[model samples]
Target: MHVPDGFIDAPTSLAAGAVAAAAVAVSLRGARRELDERTAPLAGLVAAFIFAVQMLNFPVAAGTSGHLLGGALAAILVGPYTGVLCVSVVLLMQGILFADGGLTALGVNITDMAVVTTVVSYAVFRGLVKVLPRRRRSVTVASFVAALVSVPAAAVAFTLIYAVGGTTDVSIGKVATAMVGVHVLIGIGEAAITGLTVGAVVAVRPDLVYGARDLRQRLKLRVNGELIDAPAPAAAPVAARTSRRALWISGLVTSLVLAGFVSFYASSSPDGLEKVAADQGIDKRTEKHASADSPLADYGVRDIADARLSGGLAGVIGVGATAVAGTGVFWAVRRRRTGDVSPTAVENV
Candidate 1:
């Protein structure tokens, strides 16, 4: 949920900002360990896809809707550190370009949406992966469950932040109940989307899914009288033709179509956060975003009256901007890391 300005006091917001900054710093270093020449660009595509899918908010309750937080999905498809970067990039783009989240509240949004969700969901996912059957399906199952838990976890995080610096005198108990209750429903939608997307990718090329990377199923054969696990075959090097280019292209196309067109049919109701803010009087102290006057404010271009053309253009522009910004950041990180590891960087599958 995008937290607008003034929802939290300056002190708490600043503290959250510091926390967000630290998390991003840590992620930048950790990402180097996860991304190589091969997976670095895919991370950018993942960010753009998250930006696009977030536009298609699905109905969750009578008046509330929810969108893909994308933390678990990113962590499962990419890696946890890179997943944090993906959501952070999307948040930064939305705040500065789309005027969706407030610039002053950027830290609060990132800490709650990006950091909390990624850390919680990835931990849960890895824990489940460790216990569940090590199969491609199990990875998808873990993705779903992890996504389901992450949404409520973020809600709780926001509630705690609000309790610390809430501008209004609303009952904290009521707020917590309402926030957790609605988000639980929203988490179902998150789970479904995460599961389906992860399943599709794992089905196509399990190698591309980071969570399923270790799922190299072994062969079983009869040994004279009884069946036994066959000796594992030697790992074959990936051919030059085997790359993420096809998957990246497919993901980008899907993102374009969803944001450019399907988003038109998405529920117009306020999302979980907005609905809770309005209902719980959290919006009483809400301040306008600084970029409210931007041409692309409210996901529309200035003086473009055609709803379809203006909104679609904005969506396309958002996807493009996020893709470019994300790619540049990741490429630089990869290059620096490559330089450092040139003498030791291992690129084998």
Candidate 2:
């Protein structure tokens, strides 16, 4: 959920900001190991896809709606560290450009939505994949479960954060119950979307899926009275490598379609957090967003007047900006990884 300003006090918000900063810093370092030729390119696309899917909010309850959080989906497609960065990028873009999330509360949103969800879901996914049958289907199953659990986990995280710094005097127990209950329904939707997306990619090109790497069951060979692991095959030709350009183009097109047009049909009800906040009086002290005056504020272009066209253009712009920003960040991370290796080292190899 996108926490708005004044929901949390200054001290707690600043503390959360520190935590968010630290998490991002750690993720940047870890991403160096996760992003390579194949994954590096896909990482940006994954961020854009998440940004698009999040616009299509589905109805969860009478007055509450939910959308894809994208932590599990991103983690399954890319990696945990990169997944954090992806969701963070989307949150940052929404806060600064769309005025959806408050700028002052950026840290709170990033901590609850980006860091918590990615950490919890990826941990669950890794754990399940280890115990379950090592198959492509298993990866999808794990993704579904991981996403399902991550939504509520994020809700719990928010509840705790609110308990510590909530501006209102609402009952913490009631808030927790309401938040968790609605989010559980939201989690089901998250699970389905994450599972289907991860499944589709794994089926098409498992090699491109960071989490699916080394998923094949190692072969065993009978050797002189012993069963030994078979030798790995030689690397394929550069020409044989599937071009990610096609997948990237397809994903970008799908993102544009979803955000540009499909988003119009999304439910109009308040999202899980918004509904809960209104019900629990959490917004009693909520302040206006600093970016509320931006041309693209509230997901509409200024002076467009046409609801469809305004929102559509805004969505398209959001997708484009997020893609460009995310691609730039990931490319820098990838380049840094390359720069760490000296020319002599590459020549030696």
Candidate 3:
């Protein structure tokens, strides 16, 4: 949920800003370990895909809607640290470019949506993967449960933050009940999206999925009435490896289609947080976005009256910008890891 300005007081916002900054700093360091050769590339794609899916808000209740939070999906597809950066990038882009989330409340949104969701989902996902059957299905199952819990966890986090700094004098208990209750429905939708997306990626390129690394069951073979593990396949030639270029291109194209075209059909209702805020009077002091005058404010171009074309163009731009920004961050993290691993660097002369 994108928290607008004036919802939280200045002191609380500043405190949250410090917390967000610290969380991002820690993630940047941890991402070096997560963004290796294989995962670095997928991390960018995960960000782009999350941006696309988030555009498609599905109906959750009569007036409330939900969208992909992307923490669980990203953590399952890439890694937890990188996943936090991924969602943070999307939130940043939305705040600066689309003017959806408020600039002043950026820290609140990042802390609740990016940090809390990623940390909670990944922790639960890893725990479940440890106890559940070590299979591809287990990864998907863990993703579902992780995503399901993460939404409510985020809601709870926001409720607590509001209790401390809410501008209005609303009942904290009522606000918590309303927020958690609506988000629980939203969590089901989150679970399905996370499960399906993680399943699809794991099926296609289990090698690309970081969370599935330990779930690779060895292929069993019957050798003279005895069970034996099959030998691992040799690495493909460079030419054979180049064939995956098409897959990457296809994935980018699909992201564009989802964001640029499919997003037009998404529900037009307010999301879980917006609905709850309106119902609970938490939004009574909400302020307009500082960037509301931007050309691309609210995911539409300035003068393009055609709703479809304006929205589509905005979506395309969002996907392109998010992919580039995410790739740059991940590439930098990967390179830093390489530099740290060098002999001279490690030895410190």
Candidate 4:
């Protein structure tokens, strides 16, 4: 959820900011290992796709709504570290460009939405994928379960953060109960979206999926009295698969269509966090966003009276900007990985 300003006090917010910064720093380093020709390109598209799906907030309860948090989907498609960065990028774009999340509370939002969700979901996904049958279906199953659990995990994380720095004097127990309860419903939506998206990608190109990598039961051959692991595939086919330009183009187009048009039908209700905040008096101390005056504030362009066109255009802009920003960040990380290799090092024949 996008935490607005004044929800958390200065000290706690600063602490959370430090935590978010550290998490991003660590993820940047970890992504170096995860990013490659295949993943590096798709990582940006994943971010954009996440940004698009988040716009389609589905009804979760009587008044509350939910959207794809993207941590599980991204981690399954790309990698955990990159997943965190993807959500972080979306949050940044929303806060600064759309005025959806508060600028001052950016750290709190990132910690709650980006770091916690990615860590918890990816951990669950990895654990499950290891134990389950090593198949595409198993990967999808793990995605659903991981995403289902992650939404409530994020809610719990927010409650913990609020318990420490909530501006209002609401009962912490009540807040926790309400937060977790509503988000549990939201988690179902998250799970469905994650499962479908991950399944689709894994079906088309398992090679592009980071979580599916090495997930296939390694082949074995009977040789002389022993079963030995099969040799790795030739480099040429592998290289060909890595250049997933078609998949990349398809993903980008899908993102554009989702954000540009499909978002218009999304439920126009308070999301899980907003509903909980309003019900729990968490917004009593809420302050106006600094970017509220921006042209693209509130996911609409200034002076564009046509709500559909304005919001659609803003969504397109957001998707484009996020894709570019995310791509740049990941590309640099990939380059950093290559740069670390000494020029004099010999390549394995």
Between candidates 3 and 4, name the one with more favorable TM-score: 4
Better of 1 and 3 by lDDT: 1
Q: Provide the overall lDDT of each model, using Cα atoms, as 2-decimal numbers.
A: 0.90, 0.91, 0.88, 0.90
Query: Pairs clashing in candidate 4?
Result: none
Error of 1 at 237 (Å): 7.0
Which digits, one per residue and each the tens of the lDDT, describe model 3 over residues 230-255? 86555556753564455567778989
Reference-based TM-score of each model: 0.92, 0.93, 0.92, 0.94
What is the overall TM-score of model 4 with all chains considered together?
A: 0.94
Q: Which whole-number lDDT from 0 to 100 does residue 312 have in model 4?
A: 94
State, as a TM-score between 0 and 1, how close model 3 is to the true structure: 0.92
As a whole number from 0 to 100, the lDDT of residue 131 in candidate 3 is 97
Residue pairs with backbone overlap in model 3: none
RMSD of 4: 2.4
> What root-mean-square deviation over C-alphas does model 2 reach?
2.7
Tens-place lDDT per residue, model 1, 27-89, is 999988888666788889999999999999999889889999999998888899999999999
Candidate 4 Cα misplacement greater than 4 A, ranges: 217-243, 343-349
